[model samples]
Target: MASEWVVAKKCLYLHLPLALTSGGSFLYMEQYIVSARKYRPSTFASVVGQQALTGTLKNAIATDRLAHAYLFCGSRGVGKTSCARIFAKTINCTARTPQGEACNQCDSCRQFNENRSMNIIELDAASNNGVDDIRQLVDQVMVPPSVGRYRVFIIDEVHMLSQSAFNAFLKTLEEPPSYVVFILATTEKHKIIPTILSRCQIYDFNRISIADMVKHMQAVAANEGIETEPAALNVIARKADGAMRDALSIFDQVAASSRGKITYQATIENLNVLDQSYYNRLVDAFVAQDVATSLLIYKEIREKGFDSQFFINGLGLYLRDLMVAANPATLTLLEATDDVRQQMAERAAKLHPTFLYKAMSLCNDADFNFRQASNKQFLIELTLIKLCQLLSPSPDESGSDEGQMRPLESFTTSSPAPHPIDIPAPQPAPAAAPTKAPTPAAPAAVHAPVQPVAPPPAATAYSLGGLSLRSRGASAAKAPTEPSPAAPAPVELHRSKPYSDADVERAWGTVRRSFPAEPMLTGIIEAAVPARKDGDSFELAVGTPMQADIVGKQLATINRTLRNLLENDSVELTVAVCEGEIPPAFWTDAQVLDHIVANHPAVGQLINKYKLRLD
Candidate 1:
């Protein structure tokens, strides 16, 4: 049945023209033009995008300030070679032309256009990257141009040249003959050595803009008599990513597939590209924290033969675009259509900055580890799950009353209210001290009635100076019942001498010595300074909030030890986050080692021998 259909289709096509002619009718048949050939830029003005680079070159030519060695650096298909060829022709053309354009009518220009110009030399360094090739090129450079005044050598993919080959060509590149001009083009500038880079006048070409590419595509479509949707052309332009050659290739594929009538759907289908709607759905799923839906979408794409890596990469790029749209300063960098941009901006506004940062980080990490992962699909799924988690508030940030509620042990029952009490009463003296010192009870008896009993003050309610129990509410609280004579009154432990600076310093020394040898713990202690002494309490100033938190956890134990040594039950500790100089002695072992390695060459050598990493 298939063979029969093929024969019937062929017969109909073969006889249709004959049948039409026999009826005495003349129907004009449009000429067929491939998109790549039809859309090729014919003039400097016709080149899509790259206006700045092209304009600069033209102006330079007009001013007669041509460099002997030129290096064109950019990605593929941005017209590096085409520009070089045009520049070469414009320079050698004998005929006078406006705007420094090549006169195609001139003998030199005609020869170049016909590919028969002896003065112009073109080499693909990719296939000819060897010492012998460079030697041969040097030999050719020794000869003068047969027709044009200057001989031009255009080498594409010059970075492909081997190290030896690059070295061989260096002398000639740096000091070419008066009549010889060299133009080297490369997509990978980093691969080229500094010596080679220094020898050439570098011209970095930018990726063509989507607007310029679309406009150029429209012109090509008009000239070819092909009806096309603006939206379709825009999609083609984006898929090209600022490369005119890629855009033309996509254009050709779409034009053929759509039979000269291109629409957005047809272009996307022919390109085997995921539609914008897919990206939209993926983003929606991500925002909604629908991990299943995200995974399903990924699976569908994978089932459709799209590469996992490509899909992941595209998703990352899409996320990057959305991130850019979220910020006004970076919105201009988004290359999507106006409708897509608006959608992105709306979605970006809904996303929290922290969530966006986390999602981007996850995607980047997944991308980096994708190739090395054993289960690539699972890796992507995991990344999507992580991204979904970003949409939901973290457990620590959910504001759940239960999560914030402390255990019974952590709660203080001294307060009348349901909230935990924050009373900072002095620790009772040990049993042995009570038997030894009966005089200690005298101060307590004297001050106990005078010092009114009051509710523990909230840290927020009280100022740093001190909380005044007497002034806040002396009349509201009921008096405490007198204790039995057997239960001795609490001793009002006091220092005969107020805490001196030396005492505080000694306390700091004891606290510092008590810290565990762990690097992280030591680091916190080192950054903290003894700010001041208030009665029995010592105030510690930490360098950062993080350091303050670290020391705050250990404050109770530290205070107990300090108070025990001082024989003062009223001893207390306070930590305040402050900005101050980090002491030199605070350096962790790793920091000290790094400092030594960075400053002393001998230490660096020793470090390298041990293959050590700083903690």
Candidate 2:
């Protein structure tokens, strides 16, 4: 099928007339032209999304600084070969424009445009990629152009040439005749040998942006007498994924399907894309913490025959776009049409930035584990459930605890209600105590009731990683589910109960799990052999001050966890060096390997028997 498409595309570009047998007569039909070939750039100024490259080529031509060999590198349909053809024609034209474009009226330009010039050659290196082909090309280089000043040889898909073929062509490419200009084009630039790369002046082409693609498609539609909605064009542009040729092809496809009147609904249906409404609805469900609604939305999308992985990936991208749209500075990065962008912007305004970040993170994780998941739907559903939970407020005890999660700051609406708990006014500060690192003073006793102080009526909503799903209307029946803040209290260190060795051990074990990313720190915590002292402070025994320093940096979080787990508010942590206890960094790579081997002798035996080299 791919070969057939290639053959058909070649036939189209070649414009081979078809012979049709009419009644008692033979007739030749005009060749059919695809949009890609029909709208292919004829001049440097006509290329899309490659201004820098076009400018450089034009400048080089104007300045008369052409190189013997040139390499145009980029993905398909970014106009590498088109530019090469344009450049070749421009350089050979007898009457060129001031902007360095070829004059179509010139005999040389006319002949090249009509595919009758012998000055240019195009070789498909994918098929003719052997040393003999390179030798043939080298032989052709010795012959001067019959009509133009320079003989231009364009090699398409040049990376397919074998190493031996590349080597065979290297000498000719490096020192071609003055009249010969070699132009190499390839989608995979990295596969070309470095020797070939060094010989050519390489120009990298960028992918066409969605905006550029839309603008170009609009022009194409207008010329073709087709009517299209901006939203429909935007969908086509995105579906093209940065290839102008692809965008034009899709434009043609969509144009045919819509019968010259394209709409967004028609596009999504034809493309088999999940509806945009799913994203909007799911986002609302996420903000509301409505798990049931979110799950139902997933079911509807799944019923539409969309792949779970594809849907989840799209959801991740949607969340990312929301994150980008949430900030004014990054709004320019949102690639949708104005109406779609405006809708996204409104959703972004209501969404807390942290919530978007976490939501995106959850979706990204699910996407990463999608292939390994035992139940794909369950994985997707679990991700949605987690996203919904992010909007719910966590308990003050759990939320305030070290390593515990809290709902992201809420910004769902204009006005946010205050928490239900009555927050007492702060008391005046007492004079500082003489002791070092003196503890905060305990609050004075309060017998009277405190009132819940609300934020100003005009104030915006704010919560922790997610929004409070409070009722938008001013109705008392609909209650917000946010947890209350803790009462103002201070610790009395003197009245604190002492923790036991067993309690310390248990607390240490539980606290260390919080730093799974830092296994080294976990190991240090275990090796330190912390012992309880008579004072509030507990000491960690280690070999060096460096280990102590490492532990000290994380001391605050560690102390908080210990204090919570041990049920004591007055827990202090410090490190004391004991030289022989822990080795600093396990000395070297070999020593580290030895330690691993010591833990499991079978691994060491396997290493020795296999004669493994780590590098």
Candidate 3:
């Protein structure tokens, strides 16, 4: 007996430790739960950032007004399937309370918790999106629930359902059995056909608010006994963009990266986020018109592995926030911490409204063109330079009027008071004596016979109209001189008579055909009537200064063309603004020119001479 007891003691010592070690390993394994499943909302009340959706579902359950087919559409991770499962449990719970909540103490709820529920079915349509899979689902829908009152079928990613599968499932989806309930969830509702959309009650889920996400994350951190900063959690919440599941996933990543204590710096570094300080400094530089500082901030961000495109896009969004904060009505939309919000408000106040508008426009343009730009860094730098220019006063208006005016020093001064000088008037010179004298025997001979020299035939003067020409010696010697070899014979000059009303009409018709399709010129041409003609010079009356200027500028070109057409180089053109019976095409270049000069003097001056009409 003593020998048996010694052997048993040795065996017990060895076996006891092995059994204890196995139990210790099991205990350690049991301590951890993945953040995803550990934080999944177990009850309707436990869900985060979906109070309205959950409340509506609860009210429906309470009123016993359940739809046969329901559709939930939203971005991913915004509580689609979780709501479906909760709805399934609430409706089929054996011990459902009067308030329409499932009692966890019941056998049916326990089966659901254990993943053994017979009435609820989930199908991932992304992988099983075929006619056969849908047919199988239809077949299952025919069967009654064995353990619950209603059979719930949850189809996830319902948008992925094949066209044939959707068609095959449509009849049953529209008219399922009284005991059947179908819940479809998808991120893209547009992909789902209109027929399918028409048969279901759609619920659109919104992105979770940052405050709500942070509150839930804080609750999670508290439950896990992890330390976190509110600022750090706020960053994670914003990064999640309104999806609670995404927030929790990010929380897990950040918590792991930080070894359970998340600081703002750790969160930013782990996420590879450009620091807010950089954005703040950039904005400060923009406010102060500091291009060098803005460029330096951009360089630092680039060095930190942030893409220039993303940096520009983020800067655009930041400016947009500043714009929103500039107004009290839009301040609510700015999603930042209180401290950051106050800083934005202060910065917004310092910026001019027009400057902000122009800055925002520049940033947005840079973001849009960043992708196509060959030298993207230059594009960003140019955008900063433009933003800086916006803050400075325009060069045209930067100085006072007095500073722009010409100074007295620029004027040329006259030489000091020139003295008067005395001068004498010149006397006329005496006439010279004749070189030869003739002796006459009789008075008739001395007087040279006193015979009148008849004027030459070429020297005889005749006037055709207002113009006349005479030979050079005709006035002095009263006789024509022989034509010189070097000089051509002079032709008589004649004045042109003024055109009659009929003649004026004929000339305007000629002008009209000259400019067939130019409306402004055509209109003016049609409105013009000959006012007067003086010695080959014609004048046309226009109703306004604009028309006068137009015709006046075109006068030279028109005159040249008219002279070539009419074989008359002496023809001249004149335009004058007058008050008279306005023609049908009464708008003259004068009125148009006046308007153009009024609105755009530079354009007017570039195109034609402008004269302001005085009323």
Give the best candidate by lDDT: 2
Q: Against the correct fold, how does model 2 do in TM-score?
A: 0.63
Error of 1 at 180 (Å): 2.0
> Which run of 10 residues does model 1 get worst, by summed lDDT?
406-415
lDDT of 2 by residue, 1-615 (tens): 565555555656788653432231333465445688889999999899899999999999889999999999999888899999998999999888998899988889999889988889999999999999989988988998888798899999999998899989988888889998999999999998888899999999998888888888888889888888888888888888888999888887877788878788888888887777899899888866678999999999999899999999999999999989878789878886666677788778766665787789999999999999999999999999888866432212111222222222221111122222223344332333111121111121011111211221222322211211211111111111222243112222432666666666656655544443333344446443445554665555433333344455456556655665665767666555432222424343333433454445565444423323232
lDDT of 3 by residue, 1-615 (tens): 565455556657665422223223322223655576688887788878788888899899888899999999999888888889989988888777766678877878888888899889999999999999999999999999888789999999999999999999999998999999999999999999999999999999887778777788888899998999988988898898878888888899999889879999999998877777787788777755577998988888999899998888888887888888877788878876666667788777655455566678898999889889999999999998777655332211211111111110111111121121222233332233111111112221112211111211222332222111111111111111122233332232333444443444444445544432233443455545443346666555444444454455445445543443344556665664443333324433444443443455464333311111111
Number of clashing residue pairs in every model? 0, 10, 8
Give the Å error, residue 80, model 1: 1.0
Model 1's alpha-carbon lDDT is 0.64
For all candidates in order, the CA lDDT equals 0.64, 0.68, 0.65
| Model 2: pairs clashing at backbone N, Cα or C within 3 Å | 407-464, 407-465, 408-464, 408-465, 408-466, 409-463, 409-464, 409-465, 410-463, 542-578
Candidate 2 lDDT score at position 356: 81
Per-residue lDDT for 1-615 in model 1, tens only?
Answer: 565455555656776432222222322244444466555655577666788888988888888898999999999989898888888888898874787788888898889878898888899999999999989999999998888788999999999999899889999998999999999999999988999888889999988878778878888888777899877988898989888888988888888778879898898888877777777788777766577998999888989898887887788777788789988888879885666577789877655454556667788898899889999999999888776655332321211112111110111011111221234244553433211111112221221222211222222232323422112211121112122233323244454445554555555555554433222333445434444454665565433343344455456545544554555557666665433333446644533443343345465443323222232
lDDT of 2 at 297: 94
RMSD of each: 18.6, 17.8, 27.9
Ranking by TM-score: 2, 3, 1
Model 1, residue 212: what's the lDDT? 76
